[model samples]
Target chain A: MSFLSINSIAHIISAIIGTGAATAEEILYFKDIRDGKIDEAEARHLRITYKIMHWSLIILVLTGFGILAGVRIKYGGTKTFYSPVLWAKYTIVLVLLANAVLIAARKMPMKWAGSLSLTSWYAAFALGRITEKTREIKWLADFLSKFNFVELYLITMVCYILAVAIVAIILNYLKKIIIKKQ
Target chain B: MSVLLQFSLISHIFLGLLGIILFYAVLMVLFKPIDFKRIKFLRRVSLLGLISFLSSWILGGYYYVVYYGNIVKPLIKKSAYPWAHSIFMEAKEHIFLFLPFAALVAVLIFYILGEELEQKQAIKKTVIILSSLIVILGAIMALTGIIISGAARLR
Candidate 1:
């Protein structure tokens, strides 16, 4: 197996584990709230979810940069930063990461989980479509093609990160709504 | 394109759209308080999700044979995307296969078992397993695409 394979497989496993842990925590938390056993539920699940999301974000960034670094060495690539798609992706990821931190701090709005999830998924889907289009266009033998697949992938990942942040905001909002109603 | 490939592409796009819709519906249920009415909505959404998920993969398989198997498969050894490497490509293949199985498990758990947080231990476990699988599988698929594209640059 190449070093790329080793790194990718490790990243894949971590992503799966992180998502699984977060999902489990959310399900259990929701169940506890639904059963009016909120107090009975361990408070640790929220912390665990926070930790999972944080570490996953770290892994995602690290792997992304690692891939870029590896490519730089192999291709004798010049560093250029004039990619719109990459910029878009970076902005989205940064915003999303900030939201996740807020969620971990219990400072985000919870009432919007439904909307947040919907929007997040929509953003992710759009990002995927755009990523595909970018690749197709970038590979076009045009003299000044700007939409490379790697850039597109970066944008897509950033979109996903943003979506995650939206979820965190929505979760916070939902919690508030439920609390107020009670 | 061959008939199989054409069918596969259409099916894949259709299923992807349907899955996205169902994903939103599921989110609504999770975020909002569940009432009887919401449960009914959930049932409808889950069933629809199952159909679309199945269709997407059936088409995806066809696409795999036509596009990857015949054309890109042979050329990959020589191709390299900017961030791509050969091993990354192989791992992508593994993820593409495994993620679908994980999705299948999630669909079965959520739709077939009709167990979405009834609060019983078994039901809870089933729902957890289903949701967790979906989340994890989705993440894996996304990551695989990124790495594979990156690795392709090496060729």
Candidate 2:
């Protein structure tokens, strides 16, 4: 395989693992906390998933740099590096890293951070798959380019909050029903 | 690009990335309650961050002085994305100068406080804010670097 292909495969695999771990972490956190607490076993499971996520992140970062370096040498200044979509992905990745730290330190209102963590991984994954030439996604790059980082962050904040709220509310109702039956 | 210029540019960026990581480590340490173990850890990481920032400054400054102005700057200015240099690079060069100083202050704070930094809630909060800014500024600089390179390459 070409070096770029190898690097791309590694990057994509790690991204999938990280995103999956984040999704599972969210579900486990919500369910475990429904009773207002998490047992040692439940917390340990969450920790394990978090560790998995971290390991994936490390691999993703290394392989990502490899791909970027390879592209830089071969493409001789393609717009890929300058794309707004790519930078947006970079921003989301930064948010994910910072959010993980906040969650670990137990600082800040975790609801926003937790919801962001869940939504951002999916957002990043989507962003990665959608390129400037991506047929249906052609408009998205231009649309995303319209705003600066601060504005984009505000938009992401509103979207994630709304999305997580809808899900959390439904989960709350389901848990109530389940408890009533028990 | 000459081999020297390329090496300097890569070294500058790599050091900057390392500095950002170390700044994140410092911020993570500050997020928790201060303690003896944490204080020791903070000292080590902050000092490393300080070194990283200082080293990046020297290397990047060398490139800016010796190579960027002569060759890269003109290319970026004439390129289609002049804003990459005019706006992003303009902001980045100035903002980057702040990092090493900020990191130095953090090192001093850690040096002076030792374990006593735990009791000084106000001081601790100040460090937290400082570290947070460093991380954000570093991230901005990284983004700006991308634009600068992209613009330079456009020619």
Candidate 3:
């Protein structure tokens, strides 16, 4: 395999690990915080989960930069680097990082940040996969070829907002069900 | 690009990255409970972030005005990746203009608030938010720099 392929694989793996760890952390936190109260042991477990997530993030970022550098070195001035999809992916990744920071600081509303985290991670992952596969998929390439990036970005934001609303409603319903069971 | 211009550009990117990393460090530290020792370390890190950001502003500004506009911009414009210049670079440059101010605010907050930051919830939150913004913008700028550099390779 070429150097780029190796880096790409590492990048993808890191992303998967990071996303999985984040998901696990979120689940653990939610499950542990019964009746909006977390005991010391549960809080410690959550902290450990966060630490694992943080390491995964560091690996993800390092491998991501590696892939980017490899691409630049191999392709020189190719349009791949300037693809609107690539830009959108980068923007989503930034949002993910920002959400992580806010979540750490307890500044963001939990439900919104959780939804944003999931949306940003999955969106970035999907975009990356699509960009990689576009070369082999004629219709996908053609569709992306004609799409305006700004419009696509705005559409993505609208979708994420709607997704957050749906998630909030579900969580509320689940909370009520759990309370009723108690 | 001339050797000096290249040096400036590389240094500019490096300093900007350093500033962003230090800002992240500040954020991590801020997220924890602040004590006398941690506050001292936070002060040092914040000052370093301020210096790195200011230096990057000078180096990047010099390169942008002197080399990028005159030399690199035209090359990328003629290349296959003009939007890298028209869109990403344009946004990067404008958003980067905010970093120095944000860094300054962070430094001033640290200087004025000192240990009192532990007690001043409102001011502490403002500093955290501003620091986080700086990190986000810096990360975007770093990524945009890569796109711009790739575009410049067409020449």
Candidate 4:
């Protein structure tokens, strides 16, 4: 397979594994805490899950940008740095990822972790959708057509991060019911 | 934006957010070692979240078909990438997709695996792990979708 194919497959596989780790960790984290072993398991699980997530993130950024650049070259166009969508998307991803690191690394409180994780995930999805849809639009097609893959990847992450923060705020406000329950 | 776009976007955003919230909630409860005091509340919250997330996904999918069929279809008759599309979107149409399946399995596995262990602790641990995976997978899907779509520019 070509580089793109390989990258895609790798991303998928990594996602599966990374998610599995995350899933396992989340469950175990709660278990450990209840068992009064949160301290012991927290570091190990955090390190492993963080590493997996970080590497998967690296693959995501690399491949994401590569795809953008490849597309621009294929379409014989170039997206400029001033692109609003691009800038927005990148900013969002940055915020989301930063929060994720803080939470996963245990810098943030558990309450914040829940809120932050929710924010980051939503933001990523929002920005991703925006970027994808914009590209599909004829008017947007030409404008976003520029930039190397790396550049686009950067922009996409930014958007993802910002989107998460925005959504998180809303969810947090509505968290009254959940907070009460817990 | 137009009505369809607005409708689609709203649902998309809602479901997306719902999924994230539910995924995290599950993790927090599961990872924290099921306090009997928190069990009823956490389970209730999780169930609600699951309902909200699923509803969002359903609405989001509806919007995808309607909007894409109307807008993106002319450019690319079928999905530009059939294999990826099938795994992520098409297969998801029937539910029991990778994510929900993984989630279900996590729930079942947690119940089975931790049944004999400390009730609250095992349950919490199992839920957290499962939910965390689902959340991460969701993130990957979102990121990869963009990358893949952008890459299609190459084809």
Candidate 5:
């Protein structure tokens, strides 16, 4: 395969790993906290998933940039590099990186961070998969392309904030359910 | 584009990326308590990040002066969204100058202060802010470059 193809495969693999890790982390978090506290096993499981998330992120960035460099070499900066959807995805990745920093600093609330982490990862994953060429979403292509970079960014962030709120509510509800069961 | 121009363009991007990654490393290191043992290592990384930014500045400046102004500039200007050049590139080039200067100051703070920085909470905070500033500015420059390039291609 060509250099681009190899990098593309690596990028997709990393994305899958990242998305899966993020999902597992959330699910495990809820399960581990069912008793209102974390045991050693729960802590270990959470740590392992976090490590997976971090590793997958590093791989995703390396492969993603490699793919960009390859595209730049062959095609210069085409729409593929700067489309609204792509830019939205790029900003979401930035948010993810920034969120990780906040997490490391122990600055953000765990609830907010957890919600942001889960939502941003899924948003980035969904944006990567859906494109203008997909026959089912062909109309989405024409529809989304109308918005500029700033609009898409605002839309993504608004949606992101809303998702965080919604997820937080669900988590709280789940916590009550668990507490009542106990 | 000629082979030389392509090389310059790619090198410029690679260096910019290197600079961003290094500062990110610096921030990650600083996110924890200041390690007296890692002070020297911290300075080294900060210095390298500064050099990367300055080097990228020179390389990107060469690309802009030699080829971009004469050819790519006009193509982008005449494109459907001339604002990509008129605004994004215009603002980006000016704003990019801030990055190397900030990185240099950050390097100097770490180098000259050494472990002394650990004692001064305010100074440590400033250094962290500077590193964060560099990362944010670098991301903006990269994204703006993408916009400018896309405009040139479509036109």
Candidate 6:
């Protein structure tokens, strides 16, 4: 396979692993702590999940940069590189990194951090997929193309924040139900 | 750009990233209880972070004005990714100005407060908030740098 193809495969694999690990972490942590108590085993499980997510994130970043560099070198700059969707994805990834740090420091509440982490990973993953398929959807391409960088970013963030809020509420409700069941 | 200028740009980015990482270390340290040993270590790291930020500012500013403005900026502005210049670069350059000052404050807090930080909740919170801001801003700057580099490739 070509360099770009190899890089693309690696990038996709990293994203899948990273986002999957994040989702698993959220679910496992919430499920175990339904009664609002984290036993040693549950804590250990969460830690392992977090380690997976973190390592996957490292791979994702490295491969993502490799893919970006490869594309620029091969294509000499495509509109995909300049897309606001890609920029927004980058911003969300940074937020995820920062959130991870805060979560490590025990500065942010776990639920909030979990919500943000999952939201960011899924958003970035979705955007990456959409950018790949943009050429196949002319209207979608045209629509995204009209948005300036700031407008596109702001809209994406507002949407992501709303999604996080809704997810958090649903998780909270689920936690209550699980607790009641026990 | 010249080879030396390229080296400067690379070093500038490297140091900026290092400074941000160190600031994150400072935040992690401050979040917990403050002991004298940790305080001393935090002070040293904060100083290093400040130095790195200042050094990066000098090198990157030199490159931005000397080479980028005259050469890379025009090319990027003409490329398909002009917003990479008009939006991201503009934001990155302006946001970068806050970093050195934030680093300075972080260094000053650790230097002046030391073990007293454990008892001073308000000041401790201020330090954490500032460090957090530095990390966030630094991350944004790094991503913007990538966009700018990508845009430059079009030329």
Sort the predicted structures by TM-score, highest score first: 5, 2, 3, 6, 1, 4
Better of 1 and 3 by TM-score: 3
Question: How many Å off is the CA of A71 in candidate 2?
Answer: 3.4
Q: Candidate 3, which segments miss by more than 4 Å at Cα?
A: A1-7, A34-36, A58-62, B1-15, B31-33, B47-71, B79-114, B119-126, B129-133, B143-147, B150-155
Over the stretch B104-137, how does candidate 4's per-residue lDDT look in tens digits? 5654544454433345555555555667667766
Backbone clash tally (model 6): 0
Query: Per-residue alpha-carbon lDDT of model 5 for A1-182, expressed as tens digits?
Result: 86568878998898899889999998898787778889998999998998888777767766776677667667766767666667778878888889887888789788688878888888888877874254367678777778887797688778867987898788778877986786
What lDDT does candidate 2 reach at residue A166?
72
TM-score of chain A, predicted model 2, versus the true chain A, to 2 decimals: 0.77
DockQ for each of the predicted structures, in order?
Answer: 0.03, 0.30, 0.32, 0.03, 0.40, 0.23
List clashing residue pairs in candidate 3: none
lDDT of each: 0.51, 0.77, 0.76, 0.52, 0.82, 0.81
lDDT measured at residue B18 in model 1 versus the true structure, 0 to 100: 51
Give lDDT tens digits, candidate 3, residues B1-155: 56677567656766776788789878988897778898888889989988998898899889889977987789889877799899999898788889888888888888777889989988887887888788878887888787787787742
* Candidate 2 DockQ, CA atoms: 0.30
Worst 10 residues of 5 chain A by lDDT: A130-139
TM-score of each: 0.44, 0.81, 0.75, 0.43, 0.85, 0.73
lDDT by residue for model 3 (A66-177), tens:
5665665455556676667777777777677677777777888876776677666677777788888998999988987776767766666666567657876776566556
**Tens digits of lDDT, candidate 2, A63-125:** 665576556544545677666567667777887887777776777475466667777788788
Which RMSD values do the candidates have, in order?
14.5, 4.0, 4.4, 15.8, 3.0, 4.4
Residue A15 CA displacement from its true place in model 1, Å:
28
**Can you write out model 1's per-residue Cα lDDT over B86-135, one digit (the tens) per residue?**
55545655654554454456546545544344545565445544544554
Give me the runs in candidate 4 sitting further than 4 Å from their true place. A1-147, A151-182, B1-5, B76-96, B103-124, B144-155
Question: What would the per-residue lDDT of candidate 6 be over residues B1-155, giving only the tens digit for each residue?
Answer: 56667657766866887787788778767778899889998999999999999998998989888888998899899877799999998888788999999888788878887899999999998888899899888877877778788788643
Candidate 2 residue-wise lDDT, B1-155, digit = tens: 66676667667776787788887878877877888888888999988888888887888889899988897788778878788778888888788889999999999999898888778989988998999899889888877777677666732
Which docking band does candidate 6 fall into? acceptable
